[model samples]
Target: MNPIVLWFHKLGSPPYFDRFAARWAPWGHGLGLLLIAIGLYGALFRVPADYLQGDSFRILYIHVPSAWMSMAVFAAMAFYAAIALVWRIKLCEILAMACAPIGAAFTLITLATGSIWGKPTWGTWWDWDPRLTTELVLLFMYLGVMGLYHAIDDRRAAARAAGLLAIVGVVLLPVIRYSVVWWNSLHQGQTIRLFGESSMDASMMWPLAWTVLGTKFWFLGSLLVRARADNLRREAGKAWVAQAALPAVAADPRTEARP
Candidate 1:
């Protein structure tokens, strides 16, 4: 318990977090690029085409992973928000805010790719099915949190409000998770599960797994980058921000003055 508390304590410090984020950013970005390259290779060429869906099902390589990230990131953001609310931790709130835009991007990719996949498979670009509908709501919730954060002038107050909204809106996660079971839909059942036998072939499963891993790392990289930027924005008047920015500002002006 003491270790856990100390861990959170360290992460909650702005200077500590800024340094930690910078240290990990290079590794995160490098690994994300490597994983995406590997995943794409497996997804595009190594894996065989689906017998039923053919080339169109290949879209799942991107769509399914992006859809998974959308939900996974929100649930993660909500957990961070809960921590902030319970512990009154500013770092948690900043982390949650950082996650919102990336999660929204994944949600958008999910919708766009799903639409592309649907056109050839379902004969339409969009549907009001439960999965699709819930996904739309999920995107709105992300936007709402981000918008609310900026709406208030006071940063602390904005964080608290956004945290509250995130915690409450997490109720939608389970609904989105079980939507297929709760309602009739064109979308299929879950393919990946802990207890259930795998629904997909090994060839397909391997690529899909790689895709999921790539997407996860991509989010991690984006989260760190955005968190650093958010911290810089919030701490613009602080000594560290001034020190960090001044060097770059001076270097740029010198370069411009030279030319």
Candidate 2:
């Protein structure tokens, strides 16, 4: 077997991952917090507001990133589901399951922030804009996966069902992306763009992009911590779990007696 596969195989085991997360969690949290602080400062004070939108456009700092994350999480969940379906890997299913609530949380944040922004800019708190409608649908799909997980009694069965749902739900992504073009809506066109000319200036775009990156890091850290806890809970009865859970070289003779 390839070394990379061999390393992954070892890392896939519950104990290794648990230990890895423990070591990495603090650094992840620290980095995320630092980046978020800097990003927020730049967004709030350094960046200038749009001429037309005025102060109301400030909500984009939060709304846009959360919206981006909502879609990103779903896409990630779908990819994980595909991995679980094709390879029948338990780890992939567990990861996909773990991501459901997080994705749903981001979706909710996106909706709330968009609503808040809309109230000031569009004169209402809610609109049936293509992106907003599809995002709500994405949130529902995430809820469906979580509901399915709890509905099934067996862990593996629940993961498989949820994985199937996630894979099937990938259709929502394209719909959300095309919603603005497909229908007339209050939501404006894209502000920050990669290929085309973005309406946003440098100060606004950079901070927003930084905020997005910080959130992505925060999500990774959150997932690692959650996944670690999940694995520890699932493996609680195993001998290795007991050994790994305890501190090293305790000098208690009984600790060695457990295999």
Candidate 3:
């Protein structure tokens, strides 16, 4: 077999994947922290305030990235769901399940920070604006996925059901992003263009970029950590799990290393 193919084949094993995840966690944390520190410094001190919004615009540093992650993680979840459904990959199912809460957390942050930003900008905390309302709906979608996953008893059944929900909910992702374009709304349009000149100053743009990158790495670290724990629980009775648990079991001689 090709070396790359062999490596991927081996990674499909839960124990192997768990070990990889553990090894990557520290590196993820280190890089994530470094990028976030730099991003925060630039966002807070180096960048000049907006002429109109002034310092209140600084909140965009957090709100923008969180909103991006909320959508990005959902898209990833839908991809994982497709893999689980098409190939019946257990790891993919676990990954899809693990992504739900993290996505939801980011969604909550987006909403909270947006509302806070709104108070100073829009003269109120809430509104029926198209983007905000759609974003609010996106939060409920994340919750629905989580709720459906937990409501089912069998792991396979739960994953399939929740995965389908996530795949279907993929439509909402674009809606949340383009709501401002599709309807007249109070929320501002996209300022940072990946391929073109951004509306933001270079100093502000760089920090937002760094913050977005930091959040991406953080999300991966969090997902792997959660998946590792889930893998352990689901595969507790396997030989690898027993061997992995042996140290703790030996330390406590009274306890069985049983699943």
Candidate 4:
């Protein structure tokens, strides 16, 4: 096997991944928190309000990044699911399952922050806007993936069904991306740009950039935490799990109680 592929294979091993997650989770969480704090300060104090929307638009600091992550996580989840289905990679299945709830949580956050931002600007808390409607469907898809995972008693079988669901649901991603452009919607179009002029000025844009990076790190930390816990559960009887599970974790009464 090629060296890089060999390293990646070793990385996917549950024991190695547990150790990796243990070491990296804290780093991801610490840096993520620091960046998020700085981003919040910049968003709240440094950035000027939109000349049109005033203070209400400030929620974009959380909303836009979260919205992006919701879709991005699902895309990632589906990719892993496809790998799990095609290659039968156990770690890919676990990672795909891990992504479902996190993506769902982000989707919910996006809806909430969007609603909060919408009330003052759109004159209502809820809308049937194409983007908003599609986003809600995305949340349901995440939930469906979770539901499918938990419905089966056999672990591998559950992963297979759930992975298939995730793969089929990938269509929602592009739909969600283009909904704003394809239809006349109340939600505003994209303002951030990579190469061209952005609709926002530096003061308003910089904080958003920081937050986008921070949330990605936070998501990494979150995924590692969830994946590690799930890995431990699935491998509870294995020797490596016995050796790797901390005394505090293994001794927890709830750990024994877990089905």
List the lowest-lDDT window of 10 residues for candidate 4.
250-259
The candidate maximizing TM-score is: 3
Q: Which candidate would rank higher by TM-score, 3 or 4?
A: 3
Every model's TM-score: 0.92, 0.92, 0.94, 0.93
User: Which residue runs does candidate 2 get wrong by more than 4 Å?
Assistant: 248-259
CA lDDT of 75 in candidate 4? 91
**What TM-score, to 2 decimals, does candidate 2 have?**
0.92
lDDT of 4: 0.90
lDDT of each: 0.86, 0.84, 0.91, 0.90
Candidate 1: Cα lDDT at 142: 95
**Candidate 1 vs. true structure, TM-score:** 0.92
Clashing pairs in 1: none
Deviation in Å, model 1, residue 19 alpha carbon? 1.2
lDDT (Cα, 0-100) at 41 in candidate 3: 92
Candidate 3 regions exceeding 4 Å error are 248-259
Tell me the tens digit of each residue's lDDT in model 3 across 115-173: 99999999999999998898888899899999999998998899999999999999998
The candidate that wins on lDDT is 3
Residue 137 error for model 2, in Å?
0.7
Alpha-carbon lDDT of model 3? 0.91
